[model samples]
Target chain A: MLYREAGQFKTTYAADMAVFPIRQDRIALALLVAVAFIAVPFMAEAQVWPFRTDYMVRAILIPFLILSLAAVGVNILIGYCGQISLGSGAFMAIGAYSAYKFATGVHIPLAWLGTAISIPPLPGLISIPLGGLMAALVGILFGIPSLRIKGLYLAVATLAAQFFFDWVFIRVKWFVNYNSSGSVSAPDMYLGPIHINTPVERYLLCLSAVVIFATLAKNLVRGNIGRQWMAIRDMDIAAELMGIRPLYAKLSAFAVSSFIVGVAGALFAFMYLGAWEPLAFDINRSFQLLFMVIIGGLGSILGCFLGAAFILILPIMLDQIPHAVGIPVSVETVSHLVFIVTGGLICYLLIVEPRGFARLWGIAKEKLRLWPFPY
Target chain B: MVEFGQFLEILIGGLLSGVLYSLVALGFVLIFKASGVFNFAQGAMVLLAGLALVRSLDFLVARGIPMPVAILMGLMFAGLVMALTAWLIERFVLGPLVNQDGLTLFMSTIGATFILEGAAQMIFGSDVYPLPLFPTDAWFLFESAFPGGILVNKLDVWGGLIAAILVAGLALFFQRTKTGRALRAVADDHAAAQSVGIPISWIWFVVWLVAGLVALVAATVWGTKLGVQFSITFLALKALPVLIIGGFTSVPGAIVGGLIVGAGEKLAEAYLGPQIGGGIEYWFAYVLALAVLLVRPQGLFGERIIERI
Candidate 1:
């Protein structure tokens, strides 16, 4: 096959250490990028490409991006660092509502400017990190109990955070500025001259952010921090004996994870829904994100993206298939079928390959590299 | 004295509701003890069973069958389905996932929950059904010599009695029977029980089936109290706090935890609802349970676990 990488050779340490060291992989990556930028916009209409509806693109993808970011954050802690947390959604809600307050209460003219000034951004450029920082603060607080408990008990403690956050967000009117509707929403978003109200623009913004975060995550996992996290995940006492501070490693994982998830929540609210209630960030959302990380791959960044796309796209695709086939099924019927199929698939994937789609991808790559040679 | 009577009224109502909460939690504990898996789908199962009962009654009426016979038939059918569900889970899902970690099992249950919810909605339609319990017009209107008048519904008394009977029956079954002993052994240690010629898979199936039947009884009560609607599943969340309070492993613990949560929420609603713009009671039970979990992770009555690693 054209995927063979027989003659590729790394001449330098830089070349050897590159993200895509294989020549064929680099070519594939280039092709993927080219297709995404050039072909996708031309081939599919805006609606069909990202589900074609403005609300669908904005609402689903935006929240999905935020969730994916949060998943990455949780993945670092639970998957990489080996500290399980069921409260990632709580940190996300904190990030989202806090950002909403900042965006609205600051009283700036432009939406992006308002968003920027609300957080740590200077002058005009929006500071995404501020959202992460707020989430991180909450993450650390909830994560403090991890110092005492391990495994399932730790997960339950984090679950307490989830319930507490859910209760606080719904009960406290001040958080949503006493919005009588019991929901909070953000106005339109912008990045300087670029308007993010449109789906394509919003998708681009989210995609770019996902890429940046994913790259940072990938590198972090490959470096010393990743090893520390892996060490902690594999065995805490052994990791401690090996000189890794379990507390620092675990807390840092939670902080970093919460920060990513928090920013995602901001994006989810601002870019996607434009309106949401406390119910929007319920236990279901937490479960969905958790499913993404688990079914994607426990410790791989690429698995996060694959998992997100798989979970998000499958349901939408299933909902559309009934319509596409002229079955005339109601949306609810299709949704039900989607749940059945998705559930069955999850069961299948868990049984077949618990490592998730990422491991499968790795195996395929290995097979391609060794093509035509049995050994 | 009037305030004191009002408190008693609320306390009685809460205790009654707590019985139902404990029943639901008991369902969770049954499966959890027999198999190490936490059946998150317990709430959905409750809703499904309730809906099934309603649908069967409607079907029987449409077919001109007698109401009493129809109701009995429906109960029998529900028990059969629950047994089938147990078999399916043990043979296909849980069997393969036996050695998987807790998180994987958790996700699987969540997936199963979604499937069950969707299936129930598809089959039952999204309409609320009326549930009728025995002696609908009974009430105990006692003009007490106390300062405030406290009135008790006869249905509440019946509900409490029935709940107690069911709990006792379950306890007896778990304590006296050979199957119960086998289940308890599996609950204590799956490998050791299996080593002694106990069929772990069969026990798992039997326990799940028993839990399902319990769900039917709980569903009947819950449906009568709350009406059978999709939102009925939300009541299942009430059981989570119960599990936390009772400890996942204890039946009596579930009962006590349920009573506490039930009473706690009622008292919160009665006393604190007005202060917080009315409805801290909605999440009040969970808050109380969470506090308990924070203080005692193994629950009030759960045995202390000694982790090797």
Candidate 2:
């Protein structure tokens, strides 16, 4: 009854064009954001809740948020642009290492008359986007092939990028700040008086970063540029005939997509792994992000989070399922089961509905709208 | 100079290893030609083949079966497993997705890859299993003017011969058989073949069977060379650059591409690796393929793609 939009009528074009035109959807979204930002943290502080501070902050929420960010980033490139990239991990690595370098290597000397001013070493806010920018530059460079190649060949080209980046980062010591051992530490991150040192601060930082990037991605995909991308994706020849510049649309998609993915990588390094080497952002990372985009739903924004949550959280839940039921299975066996389940689900979902879990959610809502009587 | 002799040795060894690359690429070409699915599960299929053979052999041997009987039975059992895998793939994956787009089909195969990889690992734990069937004692030494003479493993020579025989047998099977002609017809036009009473489904089944057998042979040979483990799956990826360079559809292309990539990788790693902190073998083939692609996107022997308006 609450979902029936019967009493509401859009008086303006802006109202009709709103993202959540249904009042119930808007309310639900607001409630969700409020719960994520406020209620979760509040519950973490309470002594009674199952939301233990250490487990919630360190294990589940932080990784979930960062991966969701990556899913969004991958979705923008593969989903919106209609370009398939197996090098998203390479872009992520670029973001991470670049951010690491900026955080540690930069020292700005501010001069004002007789006084020498210094802003204490590395700030997380600036370094993250700087990392994104670096990734965007690299992304555009690698994206040069989409101009000449299409489909399966383009995929191989992207794989080339993955292998190339893997080689460059590991072989070139400069990316690692020339540390004797390749893995190096993230610098002390500070935003004025508040030090982002603890798990809660790191979680909050990642949460905010995810929210900002997601909103940015959402708007980018909804706008004119996003239309151009979908046009190229659906049919490049037709898109070009209609006066859409393939070069501009394709490159912009690469840049914007890489920027968000880059930010996610930065957060992944800064918040989650803390001190990650090049190996952390290998080909498997690319596959994980690609699977998220695919399994979530290719063309929906909400699909990103849905896909990320399913892929990231499902294995953990799968392990706990056998334990909770007292099946007495080993961890290795459980892990293997998890893999089989994941693979089986992917095939099943693709066969039934190639659009993914997000489309299934849409169908559920559609069914809810028509629930009282058979159509 | 010793360098020239060493270079010649590297070329020969690379060619030998290139046989493995060709074997793997052959699996891809056979499937892709029949169905446009670009089988990502080829690697997983290879792993399964290795596990299937070893596990079957062990299971039979413990029952007091003679060595030759056990070996023959194990090979037959391995073939049976591949057939079962092919049937499962056809029924569960390709059957349901008859008219789906290439991307969806590709992704589904990737799903199949994960399932097969997990299943194989689950059945036979992730330890490396070596099938020491090939001769390991004899070393062929080129006693040229090199300070350190070039040493060649006898197993590699035998491996090459076996691979050559397999390829020759496949070529003859394709050229001389009616089923092969029907397969080519199906590949040429699925709807056309169907209209003319060719069972497209059976053709697909046969194609997959052949591909699986090819994977089995490749995996067993590779296992003999190195060992059968999760890492053996990576050899399939090594075949990818070979496909890129040779052309995805051409049999001859796969062989030539494998040889070129093998030699290029070994030469690059051997000569220039020390200057670049080593490990050039990992990405060298991919980089080489990418460079070649920029010049000729159709690959060396791949059919030229025609984009229609």
Candidate 3:
């Protein structure tokens, strides 16, 4: 009965169009945000029961938040626009390396023509979004093929971007600032004078970014452009006939998606990994994010978070379960089992509910609205 | 003259290596043509088949079984394993997933890839097992034309011959066999074929089995060349560009696509890699495929895509 929206009345168009039009949903969202921002950090600081160790905050939460951000990006393109991409990893790499370049200071020596240009290092906060912008630019370039290619063919075509970027980052010394070993470490990150040093600060940063990006994504999808994307996805020929320019709809999806994923990549490299090589953003990373989008629910903002948590936490949980239960399994065996279980779960989920966890959540909510009663 | 000979050598080498890719691509073409599911698990299947064959062969050899008999038994064992895998996949994964969109099926096959890769490695042991079935030596041609004759690998020649035979056999099968007609019928229209009393599940199973056996043949050459290991799965990635270039549906398209990709990448790497940063071979074929896609979205030999509202 509490879950029912019976008492909620929209007095204005703005109220009706609000993302959380249901009073309960709005309250729940506020509570979640508050818990994330205040309670979780405070708990970690105070060493509360579940937060007794920083491992949860450092290892699990940070990666989960960052990856969820990336999944949100992938979902926009694949889920909303209906263009399949297997090159999200390459976009991530581009974001990361470009951010690294901007953060460290770019030096361009026109030695062949006897001129030199250099950019002084920018702050970490500025470089992160800049990295996303850079990724967006490249994403649009790679997405050009989608105009001609569709479906599985388009997906395979995106691999060109993945492999090409992989080679660029590995072969070009400039991207890494000519580091002797070719791996680059994150420069000290600062917001004005505040150093984002601790896991709590990193977690908060990711939380805020995710909130902002997700809201923006939600609004975009609910607006005219999102409709255009959905139209194109549902039927491109009909969409085109209705004056939805496939070029604008498809490319904009790429641009926005890559921008968000790029920010996630920057955060991932700077916050989670700290020190990384090109290999950190390999094709497997692409697959991982895709899995998150798929398992979470396509075309749903809430699904990104659900999917990310499921994909990221499942392996860790699986690893811990056998150990906690006193089963002596080798690390190799556990890893293999993780693969088998993950694969099996993907198949199972696709067969049972192709829309993913978000749909399941929706079903549960509908049931809740009818709790303690029946027709 | 020396440079020309070297260029010819590289071209020949690339084309031969491309044949190995074609063998793997053949598996993809078979499954895709019949079932319309792009089998991302093709490379993993190759790995599984190779591991099964090599592991069993080693076991039989260590037990003092005669060499020829052991090879025969090992092939049979691997064939049996592939048959079982085909049944499991068709019955469990693809059967329930019937009538779903192609993308979902594609994603499920990817899931199947992960499962096969993990299970094969876990069961058969993940260590690289060498299959030294082919001779690995070099031959020189046109000795009088250049300072040294154009170099060619003996193994590559064997691979070319095997690929030609495999393609010929597949052609004969498709053209002459009753099952081949059924497969074509199913590929043309699944619903119509079903209505005509064709067993869709059985046809899918046979296609997958044929694909699996083709993977066995590929694994034999590739395992002998590079040794069977986890890295063999990367061949699936390599074959994708070939698939797109050749067209997803055509077998002959696969061979031609492989040749173009192989020769083009090797040529680019040799001629342009040094000028750039090298390792362009990794992306060359894909970029070539992208270029082809721009020109012919259906692929060079692929059927023209006709979209409906």
Candidate 4:
């Protein structure tokens, strides 16, 4: 009864068209944001929460945001456009390495720089978008094959892109700046007196970036382009008959998806790892991102975040569970168990709810709305 | 100038290596033909079998058992374990996930891949274990009566011969056996086959078990060549291009595709490595397969499938 929205009514078309049409949902979202912004920092500073480590914040939360963005990007193409991609990691790598190059190769003023940069000028902010644009170009190039193939065949074609990018990254010395270690990294950005090097700072930056991109994505998904994408995803032939250009819609999906993924890649490089090789963006990473999309919810932007959190946070939680229970198991053994359990869970999730965790959340919300009057 | 005999030696060795690649690809084809799922875990299965063989040998030797008895027991144990795995997958994973879309099934397989990899690593330890198939001193020398000589190892020849025999036996089994016919029927159309009285789950289990046995043979050959290592599992990615070039459903296509990829990759490394500052061969096979896919995605022998809108 407390969760019922019986008294709520939308008087305007604008109210109905809003992302969260229900007044309750808008309030809940605001409260969630408030808790994240106000409560989290205070709790973290007070060390009241158990997961207050700097490393966890930087390594886990930052990467979580980045990967969520990438997952959203991939979902647009694979879930909405009906184009299967095995090259999401490649696009991410392109974004990362390109961002690294721009950050290092270009110069930025100290006043505009964040504290992550020791150098006088920092180009990291500019490099993020540049990396995304570069990834988009590559995504479009790889997407050309989609014009001819569909389904599993298209998937294999995308796998070709994964190999091509992996090879290029490994073979070309110029991309990695001829580093003997076969790796490249970006310097931290600085904004005058404030340093973005700390985990808290990086997390904030990633959070803001994710929010911006996710908002833009939400708008985009509701717009004309999203309808065309969904149409193409459901039936390309029908979409073509409806005057939607299949080539344009598919390619644009790839471009936009890659662009977001690229930005995430830049964040991943600049904020996390700090140093990475071609092996870092291997096929395994591609699979991990794909899993994130699959388990989170295909065709839903909110699902990306849910999937990323589930895949990323679960391992850490599992590993720490033994400690919480006072068990003396070694970390290695715990990790192995974590893998098996995670695998089993993934299989379970796929079997039980292939649409992903987001769908479950939707059902829960619906149940909440109709709690008193069971249909 | 180098002698013509030297070129022949490289060619012979490359072709032999190609045969072993075909053995691994064969394991992949069997499951694909029966279940329509691209079993990415095939390489891991091969690795598991190889590790089990080595571990069993260690266990038997520690117990003072005879060498031949140990070998036989190892093969039996490995086969049994794989059969169990097949049963578990069919009953729990595949049965529940049967109605899901293709991508969901694909991701599930990937999850299976990681679980297998992690389990193998944990059980076998992270060290590379060598299983001695034959005496190291065994060699076959082809001496040129003129002056220079070429030497080929007997083990390499054995690898080639064993691969050929296994492939032939598999072909005969599929062509002549009742179970194989059922498998083929299931592959043709799952619903139709089920409606006609074929137990879909049982067929899936049997095919996976067959795949597991094939993996054992592949493991022996590959382990003999490269020694069992974690990197071998990644070599399964090599089969992706092969599956694309050879057609997922064709056994002969897998053999031919494996040969082309194995030989083509080695040839690229040999001829073009120096020109490209080396290592182009590593990914060249996949690139070639991708190019071929652009021309014929149905592959060399795959049947064309048209979907209705």
Q: How well is each residue in A1-375 modelled by candidate 3, as lDDT tens digits?
A: 789887778899999889888889999999999999999999999999788999999999999999999999999999999999999999999889889889999899999989889889999999999999999999999889888778898898788899999999999998998888989999999987899999999999989999999999999999999999999999999999999999999999999999998999998999999999999999999999998998899899899999999988888887889899999888888778877877887888889998899999999999988886845
Minimum summed lDDT over a 10-residue window in model 3 chain A is located at A366-375
DockQ values of all predictions: 0.42, 0.60, 0.69, 0.49
Using lDDT as the measure, the top candidate is 3
- Model 4, span B99-177: residue lDDT tens: 4556666677777877777787688765688878754344444564413555566666787788778878888888999
User: Which parts of model 1 are misplaced by more than 4 Å?
Assistant: A5-18, A34-64, A106-128, A150-152, A193-195, A372-375, B134-142, B153-155
Q: What is the per-residue lDDT of model 2 for residues A259-323, given as tens digits with 9 covering 90 to 100? A: 88998898899889988888999988998898888889998889989888888888888788878
lDDT by candidate, in order shown: 0.77, 0.83, 0.92, 0.80
Off by over 4 Å in 4: A41-53, A106-122, A191-195, A372-375, B1-7, B99-101, B134-153, B307-309
Pick the winner on TM-score between candidates 2 and 3.
Answer: 3
Best by TM-score: 3
lDDT of 2 by residue, B176-233 (tens): 8988778777767767888999887788888889999999988778878788888888
The digit string of per-residue lDDT tens for model 1 on A76-193 reads 8877987777777787788778777665564334676555333332311153456667888989987877776666556666776787788888887878877888887675566876
TM-score of decoy 3 = 0.98
Candidate 1 CAPRI classification by DockQ: acceptable
DockQ of 3: 0.69
Tens-place lDDT per residue, model 3, B39-81, is 9999999999999999999999999999899999999999999
TM-score, one value per model: 0.91, 0.95, 0.98, 0.92
Ranked by TM-score, the better of candidates 2 and 4 is 2
True contacts kept of 2: 0.61
